[model samples]
Every structure is written in C-alpha cells, then in structure tokens.
Target: MPTCSAHAVVDLDVTGATISKHLYGHFAEHLGRCIYGGFWVGEDSSIPNEGGIRLDVVEALRALDVPNLRWPGGCFADAYHWRDGIGPKQDRPVMVNSLWGDVEENNHFGTHEFMALCELLGADPYINGNVGSGTVQEMSEWVEYLTRDGDSPMVRLRKANGRDAPWKVPFWGIGNEAWGCGGHMRAETYADLACRYATFLHNHDGNTLYRIAAGASDDDLTWTEALMKAVSCLGCTSRPRGLFQAISFHYYTFAGDGISKSPAIGFTDEQYYRTMVKAADIDRVIAAHSAVMDAYDPLRQVGLVCDEWGTWWEVEPGTNPRFLYQQNTLRDALVASLHFDIFHKHAARLRMANIAQTVNVLQAMILTDDEDRLVLTPTYHVFEMNKGHQDAVSVPVHLVEAAPAVTVGDQELDPLSVSASTKDGRALVSLSNLALDTDTTVRLDLRGRAITATRARILTADKPQSHNTPTAPDAVAPADFAVTTRPGAHGSTELTAVLPPHSFAIVELDLA
Candidate 1:
C-alpha cells in the first residue's frame, strides 16, 4: 500500500470522435418492483403519480437527462408476448414472470404504458423484441403497432387501445443475450435469426430503424464474429447494405467470486478492490470484441452497443432472491465513472451503453421505499456530473506519471482515470481517483489549449462504502470542487487539483 502522485497530460487540439449522447442511456425491465412498485404504482395510489407512473421518479430521471431508455426486459424480453400485455387493464392476461422472481405480472405496464413513460421522460425508446419464445410475425406486428402511421390492423388496434398517433421508436433490439436467456442458441444460429427478424421489421413514418443484433457475452468474440459475418452476408448479390446497424453486448461486474454469492452492502476493503478489478476488466473485453468486429466491418459502419451493463450483486436482505436489488455505494460511483471514461475513449466504435436499470434494481440511479420515499444514489451523481461529456469531441489524455495501484494487486489499474472533451470553446476533463487510502494531487498540462477560467464539482464520501438510504438521502452528494489554474513559467497554462480518495470530479474550463 504505497502512495504515488498521478499526473495527466491533456491535448485539446488533437481530438476526434464525437461522444454520442445515447451513451448515457438507461434500462428498465419488468423484473422485481422495477415496474410495479418502483416506477408504476397504480395511478390511484397516494404516491402522486401521472398515469400510474411515479412522478417523483420521473422528475429525478428527467434531471439526469437520460438520452434513451431500453424497456420490457433483460431476460424478460425474450419470454414476453406484447399482445398479452396490451388491451384493457383488467382484461390483459396476467402471466408469470418466471425469469425474474416467479412473480405474477399483471400486464398493466404494456406497450402503451412504456411509450407514455418514454414521452414523459423525454427519452427515445429502445425496445427489445421477443425473439426466443415469440415468433417473427408477432415481433413485426408489435413494431407496426407502435411505429406505423398508415391504416393497418396493428395500427387500428393501437388506435382502438387509445392512442391515435404512432410513437416514434428509432432503436430496436432484435434480441437480448441470445446466447444466454434469450434462446441459448449458438453464435451462427442466433446470427441467422437476427438477420431474419431485421428483414421483416418495417420502418414507419419515415423513422429509420436502428436494428441491433444480440452480441457477445463478456469475451465471447466468436459471437460477434459470427453475427457480423452473418449480417454482412445479407444482400451480398442483390444489395450492398448490411442488415444490422449495431451489435449489443451485456457485461455486469459482480463482486467477490464470479458467482452469485457476493453481498452488496457491508463489504471489506478487499471486496471493494476486487470489484474494481473486475470493472477495469471491461476495457479488455471491449478491445477484444472491437478487434473481432473490425475483421468483419473494416469500414466500422456498425456501432457497438452495450445495452445491458452494471454492477450486479446479491439481492438485498429479506428481498426476493430473484430480484437483483442492492445499495449503490461510492464504490459503485467509481465503477460508473470508470466505464464512462472507457466509453469516451472508445466513442468511435462504442456509440451507446445503458446501465442495467434506472430504478429499484442493481446499481440503480434512484431507489424507492414503500410509499412516497425515494433517494438518489452516488452513481446518479456520477452520471449527472459527467453528462457534459455527451456529444463532445474526445481529446487524448496521456499520463505523465504513474498512479498508485490498489492494495489488492501490483498491476497498475490506472488509478487516475481521465477523459477530456472540447466543444464550443469549452473543455471538460473528468478525473477519478481510485486510490482507496491516499489522495493524489495531480498537475494537468493542457497542450495547445489556453485556459481562462475553470470550475468543478466532485462527488465523494468520508468512507469508501458510504451510501444514501431513504432516511438519510443527503449522505453522499456532490459539492463545489476547488481547482487552481495559472500561467506556467513556459508561457503555457497549468492546472492543479487534489482528488480525494475514491472520488470523481469534473473540471470545466473556458478556453481562449
């Protein structure tokens, strides 16, 4: 456990890759109370909801400015039948959500409810179609019901259900984790099915559908290779375009052993370090998969979409075992900032990534209690602080000095995680100090970018495991960060800031 100062060299002039706003997307599944009690509490409840959706949760999510929301499932998407969930509230068939908690799904939150929720949050809808237990025609008709503008059976049924105008859903996931819960199909088999599903998926109201195929699980590059090859083979003789726009990948960072045994709260420093080590492993996974994708798509036309990802730990005490519920600690915030930096660096191929969920699930942004109570997690603050990096050009950051490694390992984990972006004469630099014990004061050298003024905000806790609860919601929140900048002796600008241990900060600079 040695201490070492870290330094970052940022070049504003040498910049490329515009970070897509969709990278800050979120996920909402029908698992647990994520829909029933979390976001949808019945309009008649005393929670002050709008159309059975919690207004407080909606306002909190709106504050995050969530770009896109993937709905109806992780594993639940494959088993879900859209038709069963639509129609009258009471008449809708109540089915068993066997994938989640074996809990009864009342089918109240159907397609109409989901699209309405998207509209309320001002986020684009990214729906996951059922490709395993459902048929191709069923999936096509569901898309037609939502996106089709012309008069058709599906559209007419949608109007009869209540909505006259069609909802614009640009992104569609052909399947989710096909190699796992979706179907457990082989790489080659899933690829062919994905291409076939995309064929019948029609565009409505001139809305171009961004069809995404189910991709690899962790380091399974063969899946990406087979899927891309299958998609590239489409229209080889007749046309020249690929069938899929992007491929989806799902990776979750589980603490302790890779199994489902680790607890969420009350963890030792060793467990915390191990969790971070797993989080950093995502960089390696992305690199390996991106290289495989390059073999099929040398032109890099198709984007890499991480539709499902986050920290998955054991369920909370006394909660449903199948419901993946856990408290979001400062450690979770560190994990999130680390991924954001990685996504920014790989913005060329990594266009969009959605955290596992937005509420009442693993590493959620907001958690709700029984009635009229909600608290924002530290991870939520991380997203709020780093939101400025959206749609900004990625600037290269070179480490001038090595950062101290975590006590758990000798390998350098890049304790000083840094990413920079510049847009409209403004530059933003996000830094995360992963050292759990020691704070590091670093010197920032902004190459070819003159800084006139600067401001910052930091999210940290007195302890590494500090988190917010319903009773004590303000336990961990962001405060105005103090940073110093002045003219260097060599006629260049130099910035210095002290990053507290296990903290994340965003520095905004006014460039001249």
Candidate 2:
C-alpha cells in the first residue's frame, strides 16, 4: 500500500481517427432470462411495457445513447429461423433452446419486437443470420422482408404482418463463431460458405449492409487470415471491396483452470490480479489480428468487429446454470475501461465492438429482478462517463513517466490505463488505476491547446469486488472528482489529480 506517480502528455492537434460510435454497441441473445424477463415482460404484465418491450429497460439504455444493438444471438443466431419470431405471438411456433438450456422458446420476442425495441431506443439494428441450418434463399428473403419496399413476396408478407414502410437496417452478420456453436466447419470451409452467403445478401431498395463474417475465437490468427485470403484478389489490378465489409472475433476473460471460472464475488487477490492480466492481453490479441489483416487488405478496406467480448464467470449460485447471469463488480468496470482505451488506440481499423449479452448477463450494464426493480451496475457508469468519446476525434496520449508495473506470479500488469479524445471543442481524458491497494497521482500536460476550465468524475467502491443489489443500488457509482490546474513547459497547461486505487476517472476540458 504505497503511493505511485505517473506523467502523461495529450496532443490535441495530432488527431487523425474519429472513434466510431458503433464501437460502443451492445449484444442481446435469446438465452435464459436475457430475452424473457430481462427485456420482454409481455404486454399484459404490470411492469409498464410498450409492445411487450420493457419501457424501463429502454429508458435506462437511452441515457447511455446506445449506438447499435445486435440481435437474436451469439450461438442462437445460427439456429434461428427469421420466420419464427414474426407475425402473431399466439400462433408462432415454440422450439427448445438446445444451445443454452432445454427451455422452450415461445417466440414472443421476434423480428418485429426487436425492431420495435431498436426504434424505441433509436439504435441501429445489426442482425446475425442463420448460416449453419438456413439456406441462402432464406437469408436473402429475411433481408428483403426487413429492408425492402415496393412489390415482392417478402414485402407482401411484411404488409400482412402490419408493417408498411421498410426499416433501415445498416449492419448484418453472416454467422457467429463458425468454428464452434455456429458450426464445426473448418476455417477454409467457413470462408467459402461466407463468400457464397455474402454474395446473395443483396442490398435492397437503397439499404446497404455492412456484412461481417464470423472470425477467429481468441488468438487464432489463421481464421482471420483465411477469411481475408478468401476475399482478396491477388495478381489483379485492383482487389474487390464489397465481398465482405468486415470480419469479427470473440474474446472473454476469466481466472480459473480449464472450463471453470472464478466466481463473480469473493475472489482472492491473486485471482483478481490474474483476471486483470487476462483482460489487458486484449491489446496483443487485436494487434496480432490487425497485422494479418493489413497484409491481406493493405488499404484497410476491411474493418474488424469484436461483436462478442466481456468477462465470463461462474453463474450466480442457485440461478439456472445455463443463464449466464453474474454480478458486475468494480473490477469489471476497470476491465471495460482498459478495453475502451485499447479500442481507441486501434480506431483506424477497428470499426465496431458489441459487449457480450447486454442485460442480466455477463458484465451487463443493468441487472433486474422478477419484480419491478432494476439496478445499474458499475460497468453501466463507465459507459455513461465514456459516452463523450463516441464519434469523436482521437488524440494521442503518451505516458512520459510510466506507472510501476505490478508483478503477479509469472505475469506483469500495467496498473495505469489511459485514452483521450476530443469532440465539440471539448477534450475527454479517461484514466484507470488498476493497482489493488496503491494510490496514484497523475500529471497530464495538455499540448496543442489552451484549456479554459476542467471537470472530472470518478467511479469506485470500498472493494474491487463490491457490487450493487436491489437494496443498495447506489453502492457502486460515479461521483465528482477534484483536479488542480497550473502552467506547464512551453506555455502548455498541466492538470493533476490523485486517482484512487481500483478506480476509473474522466477529465473533461474546455479547449481553446
């Protein structure tokens, strides 16, 4: 328990990349209560719903300015038939969710319900198609049904379902985890299938699709290389650009041996440090995949989509094991901040990222109970504070005097994480102190701009494993932070603040 010191510099004029808003997107799957009680409470229920879509959930997510939402899957998308989740709820078919659990899916929340949810939240819909068991024609018609206008079989079906105008669907996924739950196909075989599927996923009525192909699991660069190689045209004057717009990969962090994972709470200090090491390793994972992509697509035409990424832990005791529900803690918030910092650094190639299931699931922003109660998790506050970075210009942050790295067993962990961006004549600098028991004072020299005023906020709790429940919803939340300002070398401004251990903070500057 010692005091640490660090120094960093932020250059305002050296901005090149605009952080894509889609990078802050979210994922929703049809697993356990994620769909039934988490989002959809049924129209007849007393929880105050709109078209069977929970209004409270929409209201909570709207505050974060959700950019986009991926639907019907992680693994469920590959087995889902778009036709099942549309039309009348009473007449819709019921199927057993074999992937997550053997629970019967009543098809209550389907295509129209999902679109309604998106409209309510004003978020773009990114649909993942069924590639494992669905046909090319089936996938093609689903697009037509969702986005096409004028006369057609799909349009007729849509009109019969009580929708007149075509919805604006921007992003689509060819499949999900083709190496596993999506299908047991090899990388080469999936690549060929992806090409065939992308060829037929046509743009209808001026609605263009950014189709993403299912990519590697963790560090399997061969999967990414195979997808890029399949789309690239060698020995030709120019390569194709629209065969597939992007590729996706999934990564999850845990601290346990083999399939077992550390519990969400009551974990030891060693387990906590080990999880931080695993979370921070995403930087290496992204760099490795980006290198492979740069070789195949030198011009950076293809984007990287991390559609599934978050912390996975043992399920809450006494809950359905297949539900994938775990409490979000202060440590989870630090992990999120670390990921966003790394994501901002690679904004040039990384276009979109959706955190693994959004509500009542792995590292969710909001957790709810069977009754009319909800609690915003610590991770939710991180998203709200970092919302300023959406679609903003990325500024370079250089650590002049780096923080001392903490050694955990055989792994070394950098306890200080930082990222900065500017938008609307204001600059936002996000920092996190990952050390478990040491306070850190950070000095930030602001270059290329004159700062007029500054405001700061921080999120932390008594312990790293501290979480919020229905009784103490505000146990872990954000509060105003104090900072000192002075003159720096070469007529620059200096901002200094003492960041608490295991905390995340953001400084907002009014740039002149």
Model 2 segments beyond 4 Å from truth?
233-237, 256-260
**Model-by-model lDDT, in order?**
0.87, 0.91
User: Tens-digit lDDT track for model 1 on 203-266?
Assistant: 8888789999989888888888888777564323332256889998988887658735687777
Candidate 2 has which clashing residue pairs, if any? Answer: none
The clash numbers for all candidates, in the given order, read: 0, 0
Model 1 TM-score, 2 decimals? 0.96
After the best TM-score superposition of candidate 2, give how far the Cα of residue 350 lies from its true spot, in angstroms: 0.6
- Residue 334 lDDT in candidate 1: 93
> Which candidate leads in TM-score?
2
Per-residue CA lDDT of candidate 2, range 385-404, in tens? 99999999999999999889
Per lDDT, the best of the predicted structures is 2
> Cα miss at 57, model 1 (Å)?
0.4
TM-score of 2: 0.98
